[model samples]
Target chain A: MRPLIRMAWATSRRLLLLMSPLLAFYLALMVVHQVTKRGTDIPAIAFTCMFMLIIVSTFQGLTFDVEGFMASLPVTRAQLVRTKYLLSFLGLLAGLALTLAVAGLAHALAPGRAAAPTPEELRSAVALALVDAFGLFAFLPFVHAFEPSRGILAFSLAAILALAASLAGWGLDGAADLFRFFQRVLAQPAPALGLIGGLLAFGLLSLSLSTWAYARRSF
Target chain B: MANLLELRNLSKSHGAFNLRDVDLAVPAGTITGLIGANGAGKSTLLKLVLGLLPLDGGEIRLFGEDARLGGARLRQRIGFVQESPTLFPLLRVDELGEVVAPFYPRWDRATYRRICDAFELPRKTAFARLSQGSRMKAALALALSHEAELLLLDEPTSGLDPLMRRDLLDLLLEVIQDEGRAVLFSTHITSDLERVADHVAILKAGRLVLAGAKDDLLESWALVRGGEELLEGPLKDRCRGGERTELGLTLLCEGAGSLASLLPDGALQERPSLEDLVYFHDRGKESLCAR
Candidate 1:
């Protein structure tokens, strides 16, 4: 367990280092948006960066030679897989905290033009991020089974397709209706709890699949 | 003497290569040198014993317990140094040690530091920044610090300068002198083994062709050089492997006493080295195929 935690910390440290440049870019964009009094979608931008971080970090964890080295140690396959998930979870929390801080700074800087996020908006952002983050988390095991570069390519393709679907959703009446339904669900506590529950179950299922694949891997 | 490691009917196959029905043992307090050609399944056998690769068939018993059932706990008692250093390149040497130390219950920080100091390993240097020799030394330090009973090293001496190789071999000898520790290191460097290995196992094309006490193997096999006519007549069946030159035929044969009796007084009978055994064994296979 200590080994796993140590691995998680190492992974998280690497992930943060890799994400630093992109984080700087996002911060620059936020500052520009604040000074110009432009209406930037803060939550959406934060979520995108979070998703990218997760993808990049997952790719790094799966592709590193350290995985083989770790396997040679007295650590089990299950523990290795679990450490990956733990890293992703920790990265998510860190990313969200950073995003929140950036959004707060943007609001504070341009108090007359930009408004602070409402409590309801914060709830929706948190709930939506959870769903998106866990949805991506579910694919990590499968991604990990691939070569690191290929895994990143695959994740990038999936992310692009998802972006395309979201863009295409604006054209579909049923999609708008679904968005309205989500807004209503986010306003209430019960359905939001159900959504979070469903996401957790799906994430766990993905984790189990990853563990099975990793356990059977040759190295 | 009790066997520290045992393999019975072990088998594994990958594409055109197959390691078939291998049965071998290493007694406690002895260094067993696993020598073979480039594709001779030496690494495959070590990986199998380490449980890095799942077995296609057979059983591996270490410390009188099934290796598969031994799980992570069993692995804790065995240390391994791969042909390439497998430590994380991004981490400093000290950080890599910290990351790996918690996995083994018997990890000794003092020993790790001692080895690092002796090896002249740069504790603050990232693995990627270290020289190949330095990385190997760091790897040795980690493997030794765990207090493992059995050390399974795959080509630990490869790529090192003669001085470094000798140093590592000396360290291996020092480890086995404890009487509770045993080592099985695979190498193409026969001279290194000649200096230290008590038991030698020769693998040829995935098969354990010859294995025994190193001194006994040297004593039993003789390198015979005699006339080609002698090879064709008296030594035809006796010669393990030979090539006919214009002057004579050089042959590696078993049973030195028999060869001395059969050969003419002009024929040369010399003691076989580990390299001689491997060369003749490989040539023997080629000749068998040609026939």
Candidate 2:
């Protein structure tokens, strides 16, 4: 556990350093959007870019020779994978907090020009981020199991296929009814709690898969 | 003396290269030099013992426990230095030490500092900024500071200057003087092994061709030079690896005592060096079957 924490700290430090430029650019863009009254989804756009960058950087770091160095240590592969997952989760949490802070600052600077996110909008954004985080987190196991290029291709294919399935589902006769059901569920507190519970379970499932793949890996 | 490290029926295959049924043991208080040519599976074997590579078949026991089942706990008792130190490049030397020290239960900070001073390592320099030799020294410092009972090193001396190599060897010798510790290092440099290694294990084309006490192996094989007539006579079958020089036929033969009776009066016999053994074993096609 100590090794895991140490590794996570080191990984987070490197991630923060690597993303500093992008973070600055996003902040500048937020300020401009607020000043010009462009009415852009600044928080969402920033979140999306930051999320993608985090995923790419985390994958690159894991697949690089860093894995070799870590393997040589006294830590087991399961511990290493868990540390990576912890680091990625921390990165997402930090990115979300920074994005929200920037958005709040932008709102404060131009009170009448751009509106701040309402409570509902903030809740929805957090929920969506949680879902995206889990989806991205699940791909880490595949990345560890395959070569870099193949891993990227596999992740891309999985994303495309999922998108296609969602689109195809929307074309079905009962699709609108299912969408209305989800809307009602989100509107109610108890059902929303259930949704969050389900997402957490899914995330844990992904972590289990990653641990299995990593433990079986041969350096 | 108990064996600190043991391997039996160890086997792994990577395409054309195969480590077949390797059996070895390293007793405590001795340095075992694993000498082999390039691509001779030295690194592969080391990695397997470290659990970096999965074994196709075999058992690795370090300190009387099965290595695979021992997990990180057993690994704490061992230290390893790879051919290229795969340390994080962005971290400074001190930061790297801080990160790794917590993993080993017996980490000795005072010893680490002492080794750092002795090696003349720059603690504040980023790993990428250090010279190759310095980076290796940093790695060595970390490995030695752990109070490990067994050390596994792969090509640790390959890139250093002669003086640094001597210093590293002396350090290893000092480490093994405690008698409760052991070192297994792989290198193509036989002279280094000749200087410090109590036992020598020679690998050729992924198989351990010869392994035993260094002195005993040298005494067993004799380098003999005789006329061409000896090649066609009774000595032909006994010759391990031979070259037809302009002067005569030079060969390595196992039975030195019997060679005196079979060869002509002018035949010469000399002790074979580790290099001669590896050269003849790897390069001499007929020598492969002779072993």
Candidate 3:
């Protein structure tokens, strides 16, 4: 457990340092959104850019031949794979928490009476987070398994798919269908429970893929 | 003496390059120098032992146990120095140690500090900023600090100056003086091995061509210098490999002392060095089947 912590610190320290400025920028954008409420789209654009940066940067630790270095150590490849999934899961939760915080602050600072977050708003946040998480886990395994270029290529393909999704209106159509489906599911008492299960399932699947890749890889 | 590490029928395939079925052993209280050409799979063999590369066949036994590397046994028992040091570029030497130390249960802080001081390594310097030689020194120091039973070093002396190489070799001798510790040192500088290595293993194009005690190998392998006519003589049958020098033909023969009687007057028969073993292995197509 101590070795795990030390290895985690070694690999994630750079990502943590890099996240500080991104977090600040995110919080600052939230502040701007609450002040005007007029340029709501601005925050989404900023959020998308920051989230993509995070996706790309998630495996930046692997770029410096960390695989070879870590391979030399006593830590099992299984443990390394587990650590990656663990960090990514934590990052996903952190992203959702930040969204909730921003939402709460917006409600508190409103000119009108403070109210709990609407069901629609909650669903929107969940949808966005899932899509982002899906995009991340898709690339994380390949990046960790192979060379750094695999990460770049994976993300590049993602960007292209995202562009195509927007150009062809697949993103809008899918989101509208998703919103309707969630609107009904949100009426259920344990909607959050279901979402958590889905997230775990996805995380586990990603973990298995990466573990297999890392296990078979040669430094 | 007990073998600290053993590789039996170890093999790996990377496209056209394949590390064929090869066997070698490192006994405790000995330093076995691994010598080979660049593509001869010295680094590959080291990686296979560390489980950095997947083994295609056979088994690796560590400390008399059929072992899987990257496990608790490997973590506590082996220290590895890569051909190119892979210490984190952003971390200082001390910081890298701080991270690596916890992984090994028996890590001694005092030993680490002493080695750092002895190596004259800048504890504050980030690994990326260190010179190639300094980086190698830092890596070796870190490995030594752990006091692992088996040290797997790949090309550790490649970047050092002559004096530094001598110092590192001397340090290795000091370390091997300990009862149960051993090292598999891979280097192009066979002279360093000649100075310190008790045993030698030479690889050629991914095959273990020759491996045995240094003294015995030197005693049996002979370098013969004579006219081109020698290559046409019955002596040619004994030559493992031959190269043309400015003066005449030089043949590397396996039966060392026996060659002296066979060579004509004015022809020379001397014991072959480790360098000669590697050069002859590369220059000769046929493997030196004799150890």
Candidate 2 is scored at a TM of: 0.90
lDDT of 2 by residue, B1-291 (tens): 889999998999988889989999999999999988899889999989999888999899989889989967888898888887868777778887888899898998888888888878888888879898888888888899998899999888977889889989999999999899999999989999999999999888888988999998898888888776666667777776777657877788777666777776778888889999887767663643343
lDDT of 1 by residue, B1-291 (tens): 888899999999877999999999999899999999999999999989988888999999998899888867788999998888766767788887887888888999999998898888899988889998888888889999988999999889877888878888898999998898899999999999999999999998999988899999999998888775555456666778866668767888889767777887688899988899988887782453254
- Show model 2 residue runs off by greater than 4 Å: A38-42, A45-57, A109-114, A147-149, A161-185, B285-291
- Candidate 3 off by > 4 Å: A18-26, A38-57, A100-123, A155-187, A190-192, B285-291
Ranking by DockQ: 3, 1, 2
Evaluation by lDDT, superior candidate among 1 and 3: 1
Better of 1 and 3 by TM-score: 1
Could you estimate the TM-score for every candidate? 0.89, 0.90, 0.87
lDDT of 3 by residue, A63-177 (tens): 6676787777777888877766666656666666766666566566763543445666666566666666666666677776777787678767876776678658755554345
- Candidate 1: segments with Cα more than 4 A from true spot: A14-22, A35-40, A52-57, A150-185, B285-291
- lDDT by residue (B30-78, candidate 3, tens digit) is 9999998889999999998888888899899999887674355665788
- Candidate 2, residue B205: how far the Cα is off, in Å: 1.4
